[model samples]
Target: MPGESELATLLRDLKPMLAEEEHGFVTIPIGSGWPQGLVPVATFAETEGASVIALSSILDGIGLEYEEGWAKITIGATSALSAVGLTAKIAAALAETGISANIVAAYHHDHVFVPWARRDEAMAVLENLSKVQE
Candidate 1:
């Protein structure tokens, strides 16, 4: 099925699921090549380095400097890549509670990463957003 593009529909169906494992964000310098024994869930190349999101355990073992303890919340709704305002709305909602959201748009779904300590609060905000849009 085609992904939903309507903002309302997307928000109404955003069944967020919090991942059990904690993730960390690390930046590998350009030309460093992929780290050994590390499986990254998401990666992005920038002028300075390659940003990678991987399991916290792997990052710690590799001794890489990284921001750890992120909780991944995957929005169950399939949002079209072209969908507008979804990220803004999510960020805004989380910001209201002093939570920072890092969103990643994948081929299948949108994932939001927030501080691990605030996962429950983030989930609650997302659930309420969905219900309000319903």
Candidate 2:
């Protein structure tokens, strides 16, 4: 299947789906062993630490204190890695309402992380954005 590249198509077809599992971003030192079954959706290397996404249960199971309570919004658009403005458009819409977005762009889909408490509102905003094309 072909991936979407146009900004308009990406926006109109975003079809954001909120994941049922609550997630969090946590940091561990570079040399720390990765816990079993703790599959990070993404990781980043920083000068001070290594960032990862671990399910809340995994964190608790491993006895690791984590920055907790973020929700995932998987934008259901097969957007090209080079697609532009999709992130900006979504971010801007959420920002206008004082919501914050942390985005993870993968090969097949873009996942957005929003404050756990605001997941419902974020879903509403994204749903409206998609309907704009209808």
Candidate 3:
């Protein structure tokens, strides 16, 4: 098992970006069953039968208001082991500083959403990590 710091460091190879952390309409307990026409954006808490999934207000059917302070560090289309590297990097480095991250992987890029208040700090951390990337 890796330490949290180590995990954060490793995640950066995927280069998780800091995106505007907006308030998303969260649904819980996907249940053993799934919702019809459901597309989840961020999932955080999970229980045996329930999980929290956040859907951005951008969804056509969603009329909820969102906070747009989230950050998104983009992974190139060629990135390998994208999730592993991204999870490790943020968990190790930024997570310990009381910063929160919500990771969402899309078809072409991996998006990381951070608190709106700490967006600049998160971006700085990512920029530093990016400088050292291979």
- lDDT measured at residue 101 in model 2 versus the true structure, 0 to 100: 95
Evaluated at residue 133, the lDDT of candidate 1 is 94
Judging by lDDT, tell me the better candidate of 1 and 3: 1
RMSD of each: 1.1, 1.4, 6.7
Candidate 1 lDDT for residue 106:
94
Task: List per-prediction Cα lDDT, in the order shown.
Answer: 0.92, 0.87, 0.52
Candidate 2 lDDT over 17-55, as tens digits, reads: 999988888887877777666777688889868898867
Which sequence of candidate numbers ranks them by TM-score, best first? 1, 2, 3
lDDT per residue for candidate 1 within 22-94, as digits (tens), equals 9999888998887788889899998989899998988889887789589999999998888889989999999
The candidate scoring highest on TM-score is: 1
| Worst 10-residue lDDT window, candidate 2 | 30-39
TM-score for candidate 1: 0.95
| Inter-residue clash pairs, candidate 2 | none
Candidate achieving the largest lDDT: 1
Clashing pairs in 1: none
Model 2 Cα RMSD, Å? 1.4
